[model samples]
Target: MSDAVPLLPFVRRDRAMRWAVGIGAGWLAAFVVLLVIAQIHPSTAIVDLPYLVPIVVAVGLSFAAAWKTSGRTRIAWVLFAVSNLLWLIGEVIWVFYTYVFQRGPPAVSVADFFYLSSYVLAVPAILVAIGSSGHLRHIRGLLDAGLLALGVGTIGWQVAIAPSLPHAPRLADAVAFAYPLFGVATVTLLAAVGLAGRHRLPAWAGLVGAGFAVAGVTDAVYAYTIAKQNIDSNWINIGWQVEAVLLGLGAVAAIRRPEPETRQRDRVRDLTAVPLVIAAMSAAGLILADRLDGGPITGGTLAILLALFAGVLARQLLIIRDRTRLATQLRAALREQERLAITDGLTGVYNRRFFQEMLRIEAERADRADSPLSVILLDLDEFKKVNDGYGHPAGDTVLAQIADRIRGSVRAADIVARYGGEEFGCLLPGVDEEVAIEIAEQIRQSIGRLEVAVGQGRSVKLTSSLGVATAGTRGGHSLDDPDGLVNEADSALYRAKATGRNRVVAAGMLVDPVYADPDLPIGLVWLADRIDAQISVHEHSTAVSRWSLLVAERLGLDMAALRRVGAAGRLHDIGKVMVADSVLRKALPLTAREWEDLRRHPDESARLLTELGGRPDLAAVAAAHHEWFDGTGYPRGLAGAQIPIEARVIAVTDAWAAMLADRPFAPTLTVDEARVEIERGRGTQFDPAVADAFLALVTAGMIGALAEPARA
Candidate 1:
């Protein structure tokens, strides 16, 4: 795994190298000039401090080398690469000048030869490093070739350093030239190759190579002058130093100029040797211990060095071990956070959000596996009543029980979720419609039988309506169509609840009786069931009232009963909703609909229950409830029980519920008015028996607890 960079000390070691090299070059230039001047005036070599020349030049070279070396580059690579390029040019020129140009001695010291040839192996190794920058990952062959060449050159240099038999002067010249020649040849060849592969190195590296070659020729001329005793060589010495420095700087610039490989390798330090912090501490302790030891701290300080080294080693181990453990723990934490984001809390089911995510996944799986999947959705029936009556805590308990039942009923492979407040969903993988239906039915029954215990020593019986939708992976498939599973299951669930309650229904096309003789296909059966259920549901709303004629249709109360019931139920002091219990329970009567409306009950109820659609049966019977059989009604008039059965029945019941009601209607109507109203309404208003039946049902306490006030 890759890591982000840590903040670290930013010392420009690269700039340091340039300073050291520049300083060293200045001093070296003066030395070369001194030597040239001394050649012109031989006596000066003896009279002056000629020896001081080496010292000054060496100091400058060391400073320049150290400073230049202080950069962000690898010390080994610089030694191996850049230094070699400089040495190659310098040695070839110097050798050619001293031995080849003026018919001078061809012999060369082994020490000199060994020193210059070493760079040949060095340059390519670093170049190899600079080239293998993962960006060129496809060029393994080129990288391998560079590495191989570097190895061969290094081994050859080592072999040359071995005691080859001493040679004659001329042979030595040829051999000496041979080492620099080999280096020159390799660099030249690689330059050609790299040029051909210009795509690899930029144009500048090639130009750098060419410039170095030209400078090499100039150095050769300067070397020839240094060898000759008869030259006014100030120009040659100055020219060589200037040329060499330029060439050296040029090579370095090319190397530093952001090659992909150089960056890749340079970025990560070789902290493998020791933890950086411990290395710092070790370096610190060494300096302190050295200073304490005073006079040229020596081998006798061995014990101190050993102890410091041990501490350094221990710190490194601690750093490595701790870092490893920290990385592992971090990864584990990341994984856990990922898990929680995709999970649901309450049902431990996936939740709708995750279901959607999984559905996409399963849709793909279905295509790949060539299988089927179905979604089953379920919602609790009369869930609001449970919340309103038993309380929300009970509602929650019911939902939990439902979720558990769903889990138990679905196949283990299926995924289930608490779809929403009162609704749950399941995804059945590799299961078709038939199996899905069976599973749905099972879940439906499971919920129905569940008993949820809420607080207050009470338990609620539960039932759920279910919808099932299915789809196959056969077509040019996609799951983005949100309705596929959703619409069907929703339609199915609607059907289940619509045909009264506690029933299952399917979504299928309706077939006319003429074309339908056979039992429906399973799907058709479900569809038909859903259709029938949907049509059969009765509309009911708060527009319903005790004496509303609609109540007569319910109880099978007759026509005259319907008319009186309608009259009483429709106007049963619709006034009360607006009236205070204090005003309503007063011993009084209203002269008109005006009096009842002031209380706002009738008007408010009418507004609140605006459309009569939901309460078709009740609204119709209630519309003309005040119309007397004698055509004495305010809103509308119809005489002699020319009213509906529901109206008549509601009239009787309304009078009864009111007589028993604590309202501002004649001191809660004594048993006498209750009976007087009952007898008085016979024929003219009530269907005598209907009125009599209401009296009996009312007296028998069938209208139980009417006189009791349950409202706070």
Candidate 2:
């Protein structure tokens, strides 16, 4: 997880680092020159008095840095400036006493007050500079640093403060002890910032941390010397000048530089192992101290060791809690991902793939137990009309509502799934055909009664046609395989739609003469069933069958010829299966190439009927169904008396059926509108005699009621 960075760009970090390096080099050079002069004259005031030059230089740079920054950076620089000024005042006081009065300053003098105050303020100033950049704000960071502080403070108190209490003066004893305590605090903070990835932090923050770390060691050394009364000319005074120069360089680097870009790590394990090392060292120090002194652990040493152990224990507990919370979240996310993989995103139902897998598994279980398994396939009647009239979103609402009703109507053991568009499947184990049919009827009624809301306070009523197939009812290839069983159920569904929709049909019990014939080849039979199902799911083929027979009767056809024409009207579009669904179901006008491909279906239909069924009369009627009365139709256009009477009658009624139906390319027409279109196409697109017969049936109130408007 990366930290959120502000969109604005900061000043280039490279430029700031270069500036810090230049200032640091100059400070290094000045320190070397001062150390060389002090070596030659160890006992002279000249060596000590020249130290004021570098101290003044440190003060000037710190004040300049303070003048150039803002926010927390400005506050830190200002603190550095005051701290350096205090050190300068302390140095001047020491000089005045040693040179003018020609003696050392008294114990706990004003110089001691100024020097101790500077040490106290420098701690928060370093802390502020570290925090001025936002990467160090983690709670675990504070805990880790606190653990280091606890360990180091335990050892510092035993080694420095305890040894000092025996001989130091009463007024100077507490003052001498406070310096090492502050020194331990500074070391803990510096360790914490350095252990955090250094390259990820601002360039100036590391410089500041290093400066404070150096100052902390020097302070601890000074306190040790004062406790032993060994205060003399040495490297300790030079350490203060080095700290001042480092702080000055840090402040200068921070003046124009912004916070560095940071990448955050989410895990606590990403941090370094400095805290563990510190803990081990502190424990070892207590053991070594007791051995050197040849005694048992003292009260102060034991108490500090116990506090260090307590800090370690608390840190471990926090890690355990974080792991527990993370594990729980991982389990929940995995479960949700598993559920989504098998479910339909739109309806929250098991999809087709899962439904098929369950069918196979349930079939095998039913075989083992010698029980019956039934499958019901439900398809909404004229579902596309709902979409064409109210939009697809409303159609989705209706499908979801119907799925809920099916779930409510079935048993809890039944598995309901959306098998495909506007089609749902239910697996009912241990249910016979009779029970399955009754359950399917109950679901059908449940859906028919629902008034699903579409939009704008408008609701639409719908009905479903269902088919049920049970195992072991009529044993055949269907009983041997799960796929065959589903096909049987689908065939029954096609019959339910063919004989008029909104009814339940059971497999092996269908009585429709055209579908019940076993003489038809199974492949051709399945193909014909699929074609009829596609065209008449909204009762298109049924209407054409009825209307064609009525028109053929009026045109003075015999009973045998009327039966043949009716069957032809139902099977004329069977060859449409060869055409891609993309062409047939398109919502746009067909191109010339697509039209050329589509016009071949009638000839293909004729060839299939003659060769497969051995019936040339039906084949002839199928072939000429699209032939116009004029000389403009496709595949050998026969005009006037050349076109067969059966084909002419079908062409008129088929056109009327298409007009009343909700098609993708055309809107559904009202009864009078269809009658007007039929009259307009009398001699051009349709046979004059067949068109007159159809218009007469409409005028006589015989077939116009079939095209009534859908209920809202």
Candidate 3:
């Protein structure tokens, strides 16, 4: 019972709708019978008095609908009520003359005045209800309505008005002319509402339009019959009865529909075919009439055809103009989207992605032209202090001012971009090292002189460290890599920060040989030191290097091979710099995701070796150090001899060092326990030959304890 209670109101509404429809249907049937009877019996006593009841009911429904609505809808309903009441008054007068005096009214009586006035009020009523669909849409709707109405008016002129013109009296003829004119206007208003936009009107709106259109057309036909002196076929009274019932139904529908908070607006439809269809039908009907009558071309018919041609041309022109405006707007929107994608939002400079892309392009240009290219990387010194001391807003002001100063100091051809955080990069094409250094020094000095306001009587001074690098010969060899140029500049920037807070350093001043005999390259050395200093991985790395050399020597490897193995062991885990320190130092066993991240170091180690040192051999050794002999390892699963000899050699030593060390995730094993573990995994985890050599070295006491020696 509780579940069904909420649905009771809806059920009642449905029942009421069914009753209203049934009553309307029965009333229309009775009116049709009356129309037939009055036609069959010429002197029937029935007149407009019986029709008065339906009009009165229509007036009540209209006022009730008005009371239930608000805004423009309410005004429209009130107008409908007034229009219906006016028609009712006219009908009453017609009944009085027909029954009391026992004779019909004159051709143009006070009844016609009330009837025409009701149609006039309906014009504004339809406009008020349907004109809410924006200005452009409404105007277009008017043009469409005018075009269609012209066709209907032309047909009416050819059929009715032209035939009976000479016989009718002047005042009666004027009244006859007024009916079709009012019919044209009323039909045009209804058409405008119907064809306005893609959105369908409410059921009430359709019924109202249909009611008015039927009445208007019927009145036009009545005028024709009167002009012909043929009043016997008053079967046309059926249209008035239908109009009454439809208007009443329209009013009831209006009361049932809930008014929305805002009126629904519609976009103009691209309905080109509607105009063509109307034009074709109008032209075809005129042609058929001309054929049937065997008549010459009339002036009235020719005028309507010309007017339709002009309307079609005007509609086509409007469509072209609208499409052109939309196309231009689309292009402008696309341009804005492209600009946003390539620009930094805060600093209003080219962003990091664009900077990297243009760097490669500039490098290619320099290579083809054989001209120098330079890059300068600048980092703001103590930028965090500005943010911490004066809040982020002041820091932003400082960054923007700093970027402006940098832009002002650089050449017009140079591209300035925000690399990330407090660092900005400048790419200079066709410029040598000397000019690049000069530009960097200028930028540093400009930044030092600038002071940005935080707020209210307080200002913060700024300073920046800049590093400049040019694509040219370094240590008697060509150093033309774009990434190498950026890396050199980045190294120089590090030196500038280390030496002093605000200074400029050039890559040429910090030269190291491209090839180091037994030592790592200068860039690789710096990278190794950074790894050790940042994560405290030096002890394990150093021990691994020493143990790898011993194992390699025991396996009959020469000095060059031993050195390569030792270097691979030291740098194999260098890629661990990217892993978080918390993961590296976790006291508990690492999660699978953390271990997966930890395993990426070998591949990164190889990439760094190849890019920075230009040594693919060392990279190969570093990349494959973790591969198992049985093909169950991360990154790449190169088993047995497929793994590099140096990597295989280092794998044994790396494991030995890890096992002996007091690592967060592993228990430190004593010498015998470590030996047992190594022997146990000789064929599976480690290469049997490499493991045998390592075990041999340990047994002979040539290698010391696996861990680093304790400090005194």
Per-candidate clashes, comma-separated: 37, 0, 0
> How many backbone clashes are present in model 1?
37
Q: Relative to the unseen true structure, what is the C-alpha lDDT of residue 694 in candidate 1, on a scale of 0 to 100?
A: 61
What are the Cα lDDT values of the candidates?
0.48, 0.72, 0.74
Sorting all predicted structures by lDDT, with the top scorer first, yields 3, 2, 1
Model 2 ranges with Cα > 4 A deviation: 1-141, 156-281, 291-296, 380-403, 451-462, 472-480, 494-503, 511-712
- lDDT per residue (tens digit) for residues 499-586 in model 1: 3344344443111111121221233224323422232221111112322332353466555444434333433333234444444433
The ten-residue window of minimal lDDT in model 3 covers 1-10
Spell out the clash pairs found in candidate 2.
none
**Local error of candidate 2 at 637, Å?**
54
TM-score of each: 0.31, 0.51, 0.50
For model 1, what is the error of residue 565's alpha carbon versus the real structure, in angstroms, after optimal superposition? 37
Per-residue lDDT tens digits for candidate 2, residues 1-712, read 3432221222234565466566667766765676677678565454566667767877787788778776666777788788878878988898888888888788778998887777666666765655324432334445566677667765676666666567524767657656665666676766565455342445555566667778778877887887777887566766766776676666656655544333333445545567867877898898788889999987766776787777667666755665576688799999889878778776777788988999999888888887888999999899999999999999988888888898998998888999889999999988887678778877876776788989998889887778888995445224459888899889888887876577667775533325443343445445665765554435555456656776776677876677777677767777788787778777899999989888999998888888886667778888998999996986888888888888888888778878877677688899889988988988898877788878877765445333222367
